[model samples]
Target: MSKDFYSILGVEKTASDDEIKKAYRKLAHKHHPDKEGGDEAKFKEINGAYQTLSDKQKRQQYDQFGQTFEGANAGGAGGFNFDFGQSNAGGSGSGFEDLFSDLFSQTGFGGSASSQEKVGSDVAVDVEITFEEMALGTEKKVELYKRVLCDKCEGTGAKDKNTKTCETCGGAGKVHKTMRSMFGAIQQVVPCEKCHGKGQIPKEKCSKCGGDGVVRDYQKVNIKIPAGIEDGQTIRATGHGEIPIGGGHAGNLFITIHIKPDQNFKRSGDDIVSKVKISFSQAALGDKIDVGTIEGVIKMKIVAGTQSGDIFKIRNKGINREDRFGRGSHLVEIQVRTPENLSRDQKRLVKKLQEAGL
Candidate 1:
């Protein structure tokens, strides 16, 4: 049996669209996975329920057929493709056929049409930075060979900034297309080949771009990498990706940061951890030793009677904290070294001290 979406949202079947939207927003905010005490499964269920109930057509179909529509729940609520299969319950196919045509047309299925253009494609790039750069933050310039707006046309694709209604689509931006499917002939409304859904064309094509608003060219982009950013973290720069062929909003550029490993230091959360070797005399008698940190070398005191694996902290010597004020501490682990290759006289002195229980 299908789950009752109305019950899931705590609303009546006749609830208004505004009521459903309000309920969805409240529940979504409360159950958002990023929030404290949020339930991921419950949030997805809420989203799925809201997805069907919020759409007037889908809601109507759900009310009539429950979850019987093929591909309705595929990929959860994020999936948009829906297939209203042939009705098995005996009845006139007129209602279902009308709905099929309406559904396909409004939802970009078959023989149906839309006026909206697809957005541009996103681009991703990897950037390698040194450990010091990761701790201090830096900017880098990258050259990308991607689609860029034509310099001569200024993204208009017209020679004199003049355009005319598309002759192929007759300014409708979409044309009818028919194909055979399981449910007999399905006509699809698709974007016109000539105007590319813009319903307009340049009177004179750009010599550089050849009527397309964008051209393949090299573009230099400046990226600012933030301090304390972790490896493999991506930063999105909007409008820096490839523009669509027919000219829509440019996509985003995702930069994944790769930090080079440091030989001496390792980052743990906000703190930096490192190991330093101390001699037996230094561990037993106490001494000040030089320790390497992100902020250069610092003098750290080793307490008397310190044992191996003892840790000392140098405050404010690690990477800068990105969330709040002040910096992280540097933790230095101590390793006491034992003496080797003792002379006979040295061994006799050690034996005398051992006999005296020193």
Candidate 2:
């Protein structure tokens, strides 16, 4: 029986072109053979389903034939054979060549011509920085494990040798198989495992990288953190990730920033807070007091009859804005201190004045 292409990709029959492509990309990545616990058969099934659904003509025929399109083409075999040799025989004039190029490009393969330009996987790393550094921009050097391109073979996975056409798929790079299902018999094509979808095999494997085209080594990268960057923020560096297999493009690197807490200052959104202690006499009588701020100490005038726990705000003295805005204010809380011990003469004068009431 024919398999339901929509059901195979977990999409509805009326799914749009974008929806079909999205579903196929997700499923293909999940079930890719190189991934852990990936099922090659499931990946191939979805790939075939997507190939049919993504094409307007193929989708129309499949819909008319109840997802099989068994009579779309003539000859003993009703299905179309995606033969690369036949498709490329016309020298770029063939319709199948264009279609294959589009498919390969969307699937992360550089192009159909080489199919060996695979990019490496991305890497994520965590880093901690001081709050001051976050406030003022700083650069840091980090060390991590990355797969570097093979220096011995220059990422070719071959050492002083060449490669030959893959025998399993006959350089077509895919193997097609028919399966019996409830709907009928469905044909699916999958990557050739022996050549890893490259359609070619290396004659001699590299001694340093062992045919993988990458070597595990320690890598140091310098990352510049912008000013006013918030905690838990992430930054990406392009082409700084692991080296791809067989000399492809390198993946990106993701750096997550973690800001450390400060001892004297507390952060609240874009603002900062601090405590300032003043004598009781200074609070009773207006006086000039030195207030600590992130920039430096600034003189502030205290009003007469000022009470304890009173807060004073200094304009534009706090953390800078991170989202293209102005700077924030600094909030200072006042703590009034009283005399711990009084002289005997001072106590006598206070008592005499209270008794006489003069």
Query: Model 1, which residues run further than 4 Å from truth?
Result: 1-115, 179-188, 324-326, 342-358
lDDT of 1 by residue, 1-358 (tens): 6468888888999998778767776786787665689776786667568767766677888889877742465454432232323331133332223333433444222232222464577889999998878876789997888888888888768887678999997886756566554323444455676886778899999888988989999999999998789999999999898887767667789999999999988888778899999988799899999998887888889999999999999888777756669887889999999767889998897788689996
Local distance difference test scores for all models: 0.74, 0.71
The residue pairs that clash in candidate 2, if any, are: 1-183, 1-184, 1-185, 2-183, 2-184
Model 1's lDDT to the true fold? 0.74
Q: How far does residue 128 in candidate 1 sit from its true spot (Å)?
A: 1.3
How close to the true structure is residue 275 of candidate 2, measured as C-alpha lDDT? 85
Among residues 3 or more apart in sequence or in different chains, the pairs in candidate 1 whose N, CA or C atoms overlap within 3 Å are 110-187, 110-188, 111-187, 111-188, 111-189, 112-189
CA shift at 166, candidate 1, in angstroms? 1.4
TM-score of each candidate structure, all chains considered together: 0.64, 0.61
